[model samples]
Target chain A: DAGITQSPRHKVTETGTPVTLRCHQTENHRYMYWYRQDPGHGLRLIHYSYGVKDTDKGEVSDGYSVSRSKTEDFLLTLESATSSQTSVYFCAISESTGSYEQYFGPGTRLTVT
Target chain B: AQSVTQLDSQVPVFEEAPVELRCNYSSSVSVYLFWYVQYPNQGLQLLLKYLSGSTLVKGINGFEAEFNKSQTSFHLRKPSVHISDTAEYFCAVSEKAGGSYIPTFGRGTSLIVHP
Candidate 1:
């Protein structure tokens, strides 16, 4: 199986608190993405990293920031958590081949009160 | 800016019946299409993808999709579905010509296979 792991499988926090989600990959892929899954919206990309220290925003990047200090780790942080940010966060990785296929992590369920 | 559309939001079928989940896309550039299935409480898994060459692509779990470039559609189909086939299916598109590799996903279609 492809090695992708997301930390804190489930978390419940209050609004205005800061939270961080970690995605670690052992495959050493060059691209990493952060997505939030909701009922009707499917999975929306919040942010993504093409390489270490190289990042970009996605369709729904508000209130979220990401960092890739190492090739195997990508971190997503909510500077100020909001109830609307409550959703299942998934970490995905793809090679630099420019193909669209991605491998996803099990996901981290976050609930903001 | 690419977008994917899953025409049917939900489709219910009896076990062993044939099924189809429609998908369409809008993109200025050529695109690579993909279908992903998410089981209950689990992450999404790649069902199939259409990169290049063949128009019809077969994937695990007896599912297949055909890429119709003229219509900008990639619809998933299964001849005989099992109860375990019930899951949420998403259609995604990424620029085949250029830009970041991030995919644009549709709203998703929920498949219900009842016994």
Candidate 2:
């Protein structure tokens, strides 16, 4: 887990509901990323933040949003949760983007019914 | 743009047997390669990475991978395996995206170690 923690390890929600997952890191890393894991798809990046208040879209950024107000916290929000968005979400942190290995958190399992 | 491909979706091996997991990537620019292992109910852990200086990169738990530029591949290998070695492995590629680099990961290959 590398000093990273994801809140609400397990959650069951209804469709069209709003959900927010929080990732907190004690390492003070400069980079944070949000990813989803599903069967047949190892891990797909949803969004990433390079620095505080700086964010970028990833391969699968649709239906998801992210916010980074501080270096230790990166939040991922699903404005309107859908059944397709139900998956295990992982948060990763790294000191730098290049060459440096990113450390991942345990993960948050979100289920949309 | 960069993409990674892991040829096998699953690999089965016996204890103490050698095993190899194939990985290939396509990138327009120079890239960094990495291998990660994830156990059941656990987050991904870095097995090894190939940044520069060496074609053969060794990693934790007696795992190694070779970077073949001509083939556009980085395959992971281990001489002997244990039952604890069973896990899902992922291959990822990182290239310049703006001032930083973003990694693109393959689907993954599940290794089942049989006794």
Candidate 3:
């Protein structure tokens, strides 16, 4: 948990709608990550931010976008929601980028209809 | 790139019984291993990690794991488990790449502790 909070703990939206999830951290960690959890896939990183306004795409970045305008907040946006994007989304923060434990926030479960 | 493999999908054990959750990884170089536990509707909590030094690492809640470099494994064990121990466990492997160590997780193994 580690002082991380994700907005809209649960949401149900229809297909072709736009959705945004927010991750806020009080720890001032430099690294922030967005991930999605599916039944067979453990947790796939969608995107990550190393610093303010610095972001990188992960393995599963398609159909998703991220922005980190400040050190404490990272946002994940889906331009058009799809059934395939329905999953539990988690946010994690790390003090360093290497060999460090990342603290996760309570997940946001989003269901696309 | 580093990848992890959790051999079991689910394991059922009785309360107060011993249990072991298996984890293996494939890495081309030195790696760091970690175990995290997730309860129902909760975020993951770190159980233990092996960065270097000791092969036998002890973690919270009477849990321990042995780092076997030759076997490329880091398996979690507890002498006795409780019903509260029923949860999903994920194994992660990380290696340094471009000044970062973003871990790759394995499909979690659910431990069902029955009474």
Models 1 onward score TM values of 0.97, 0.97, 0.97
For model 3, what TM-score does chain A reach?
0.98
Model 3: which residue pairs collide? Answer: none
- Top candidate on lDDT is 2
lDDT by residue (tens digit), candidate 2, B1-115: 6779999999999999999999999876778899999999999999999999889999999999999999999999999999999999999988854423788899999999999
Off by over 4 Å in 2: B96-100
Give the per-residue lDDT digits (tens) of candidate 1, residues A9-78: 9999999999999999999889999999998898999999999999999999999999999999999999
Compared with the true structure, what per-residue lDDT tens digits does model 3 show for residues A1-113?
Answer: 48999999999999999999999999999999999999978989999999999999998999999999999999999999999999999999999765899999999999999
Q: By summed lDDT, which 10 consecutive residues of candidate 3 chain B come out lowest?
A: B92-101
Better of 1 and 3 by DockQ: 3
Model 3 per-residue lDDT tens digits across residues B1-115: 5678999999999999999999999886788889999999998989999999989999998999999999999999999999999999999888865423888899999999999
* DockQ, every prediction: 0.70, 0.80, 0.81
Give the Å shift of residue B79 in candidate 1.
0.4
Interface RMSD of 3: 1.0
For the record, the alpha-carbon RMSD of candidate 1 to the native fold, in angstroms, is: 1.2
lDDT of 3 at A14: 98
DockQ-derived CAPRI band for the predicted complex in model 2: high
